[model samples]
Target chain A: MLQVIRNSLYFGGVAALSDVSFSVERGEIFALIGPNGAGKTSMLNCISGLYHLSAGRIVFDGKDITRLPAYKRAELGIARAFQNIELFKHMTVLENLMLGRHVRMKSGVLAGGIYWGKAQKEEVEHRYAVEEIIDFLEIEHVRNMPVGTLAYGLQKRVEVGRALALEPKLLLLDEPMAGMNSEEKEDMARFILDIHEERETTIVLIEHDMGVVMELSQHVAVLDFGMLIGFGTPEEIQANPKVIQAYLGEESLLEVQG
Target chain B: MTAVQSPFAIGCGDFRVNYTQDMAIYKNVRVRRRVIFLVILFFLFPILAPEYYVSLATMAGIASIGAIGLNILTGFTGQISLGVGAFLGVGGYASALLTTRLGIPFWFALPLSGIFTAGIGALFGIPSLRLKGLYLAMATLAAQVIIYFLFNHWDALTGGTGGLVVQRPSLAGFSLDSEMSYYYLMLVILILTALFTLNLFRSRVGRALVAVRDRDLAAEVMGIDLFKYKIIAFAVSSFFIGVSGSLMGHYTLVITPENYGTQISIEYLAMILIGGLGSVMGSIYGAAFITLLPVVLRELMTAVREVFPNLESIFIGIKEIIFGGIIIIFLIYESEGLAKMWRNLKDYIKLWPFSY
Candidate 1:
């Protein structure tokens, strides 16, 4: 469960997000839909503690996480996949996933190098968790390959798998299906559904693909010029006049239906 | 998952059963045997080699320790430091002062010096949180100048330009006085440092350092403390460098500011760059190559002079140019360094008769 109350974010005198408010319930896939520069990413950045809010606060799992650092928020079970796939390019897919288990691991330099008992055990446990993610995403083939060498669709899957590797209570996915082919998009939609159903993960996804968003999200929030224009179920959001005018426009609604 | 038969194959090898085996230092029995053989050969080298070559090997070993330390910071962590020479001086001076003034034994002084250098390195690393790349390099360069000035001018503490005389360490009345004895001491330490460094990446911290090197923003979101890891990298790197400095000071029985100047720091940087960034064994190769180049060049020049006695003066000027040219060529053609080249060679050998 997460709550953002009237969050405002500014960059160099320009308001990236203004008075935007939304709440995501546990075990729900919430979609934030908007056109370009609609503050979807700004809101996600604010929630993840990457950007400081100028006004209001964020509450996650009953704690005020407004001022927590990014890593601290990560420790509190927040994980995110970037819009552009921010993976460690030089590292293998397995290494990138293992990094997601970083906070859970407790080996210092000495124990890590020596790796005799406790460190060795921890590494094995984490590797098992990472391998499960690799299998779940069907990226076992590229598991040992550097992330940079993977195709764009595979890299996006790897990024999502990396977030899943954290076993987070809340996962933020920013454009996870962007630049993906139709088959890749279908696979990603299925993976998102599986994560929501089987893992019971609360997710807040920012997406431009209206079809995927409407199909997968239990709730939808539409943004326009840094303001939340509509918040409802998929059917209600489809009929909302303001959302149509600001985001979907008149023609795209028929496209969504067709 | 299907097993494929090789063209020139032995029996199917034992596969890794667990994470321990998977993350082992040696991947197979052959590698383990080769490593053991190499270690034995290193230990027995001084017995077969002459005194001059033994001394050169000892110098290479000492340089290897420093190069490995530099590689951990610059190569692994992606933090550029132009202050290795000053850190080495800090170690040498700290050890020398401890042994001479407080009358501490060499063993105690050695570790103490490492700690002292680590502290200084951490202090220098503080600005790295806000700085990166060339700016961070300039900041570390400032550290080199400041520490060098202190070592040069602080007469009471560092003995000024006159330098300090250090005694060779002895254990239980057994002096490490001879070059061979000292070579053994340095060799043992080098092996331990190599093993420790090689195993470092198998741990969480080591992975964190590499992650930071690859992408700091992503590493941060993954819950790695970027600043904490950076400082730790600097401190750990300086620790090994300090130990090497102490060893060198004791071996030579002298500590001078000139020995730990900016040129020496550059040379160490060259070692890691030529050896391969982020490689443990690459550091050894780099140290050996850089250490022996001048000697090899001088020998070549002498041989050339004997052939054409009038060409000596031009050879002297051309030596520096050749050194710079070789480094440039390596950077242009083999930017991954000698380690990657060596790996490519091994792969070629393994896949012989089939160019695939």
Candidate 2:
């Protein structure tokens, strides 16, 4: 489990995230949901080491990882899929997945230079890992296909598969179902649940889809204007007046009852 | 338990084979046999071919070495370098100086020159930390200009504008002064360098380079040091080019500043662009085509002049037009270069009887 403390992030002397705190439990699905500019992404960026904390610290599995670089965070069993789908366009799906196993690979330049003994063995082993992930994602057919040529939904799945190949303990899905259709969104939500249950990976998802978030996440945190308005179980978040006001306008709530 | 019958299964899971076996480079018995056959043919060609063809092959081999290196840095890394000739010149002039001026043997001078030039390349690459795209390319162009001036102005060290004559490398009391000897020498080294470079792509460093090329931010997020790897790519690329330069110097038995001009860099760029970027095989095909084009043109010109005496005046104009046309055609039609065309042709032939 990682503890994300009450953190404030300053952007150009303006508060991007002010006094926000949340903890992602071990092997559980956590959701951050709010309206536009709720600073949900800023909070994710802080945890991922993309943004420096102006105050407070992030302790991952009992180790303070606040100052670590983004890559260092990835190395420490944290992997993220971008909201915009940051797949390597020119590379094949297999090659993109193989890159995920790069951190797990131990061979240095000397072994690679000669391509003898252990390096070859290790490379073969890593290739198997990639193949397994490809199969798991049901993307075996498109293994050789360049990611740029794949559909947007498939590309997003491929990106998730790539991050999964890293074998991270904590997986961050930034708007994993943002632009997906109903069927695609259902498939993605199922995949996310499968990953959490099968791999025992703690997942933190940022999503605008309230129905999917309410259905999937065990813990939910609602933010409004870079501030945490509500944090608790899905049931608690659904019933909170503040959460309702953040989603539906205060005037609209009274009009609904009338 | 019943066996899995899916045609798309990873592989035939026999006792001795797996998915790795199915995707192997030397897959199956037939491929291994073909590879051995090809190796024999490659080794035997130089011995059987004529002296002029051997000379042309040698030029292709040397140029291929430089092209492969440039392909790695510019093509794979997406750095758009314009100072390949500068690096080549550094290697050639340094080796020439070490041998002719310092009284060192050519054998020692060759490798040392490569390292020396690589160091100079790293210095030039330092500017990359600040500049990018056209600005970065212009910075490298500036480096080429500076080196050209140094080669011209450094009178005592570089023999001024007169240039320096290089004594041929000797191995085990055998002087490699003859064209045949030089061809075989370059062929051996060229093969080794090419194979080394191919193996490089299979390594973690190579993957990191590709990652950086695709997305530097993502690469950094994956624990790869962007600046460190970029420099390493530059150093390795420069080293290969430098080695090729040493071979070029030994092959020609002369080192000149003019050989390392901006035009030469453009030719190197054109070779990779026309051949295919980031492809080792493309480098070979490109180098061979570019190197032999002039010779073929001269021969055609000679034949035309013999047949039609009036065509002599128009030769220069025709050559320029054809040269420009070829480049434009390749750019427009074959953006993936000859390698992709060759692959399609190969697939067509492989399934010829079936006619897919």
Q: Pick the candidate with the highest TM-score.
A: 1
Docking quality class, candidate 2: medium
In DockQ terms, which candidate is top? 1
Q: What is the per-residue lDDT of model 1 for residues B25-135, given as tens digits with 9 covering 90 to 100?
A: 897888899999999999999999999999999999998998999999999999999999999899899999999999999989998999899899999999999999999
Clash counts for all predictions: 0, 1
Off by over 4 Å in 1: A248-258, B1-8
Clashing pairs for predicted structure model 1, backbone only = none
Candidate 1 local lDDT, A147-176, one digit each (tens): 999999999999999889889999999999
Q: Which pairs clash in the backbone of model 2?
A: A71-B221
TM-score of chain B of each: 0.96, 0.91
What lDDT tens digits, residue by residue, belong to model 2 across residues B194-293? 7776666766777777887888766766667677777877888888899899889878887888999998898898899888988888988898888888
Highest-lDDT candidate: 1
True contacts kept of each: 0.82, 0.48
| Residue-level lDDT for A12 in candidate 1 | 82
Task: Tell me the tens digit of each residue's lDDT in model 2 across A1-258.
Answer: 889888999988889899888898998999999898889888888888889999998999999999988878988999888888777788788878888887898876557656777877888888888888887888988998989999999999998998898999999889999889999999899999999999999999999998989899999988899999999999999878888887998986676556
Model 2, A117: alpha-carbon shift in Å? 1.4
Question: What's the lDDT for residue B274 in model 2?
Answer: 85
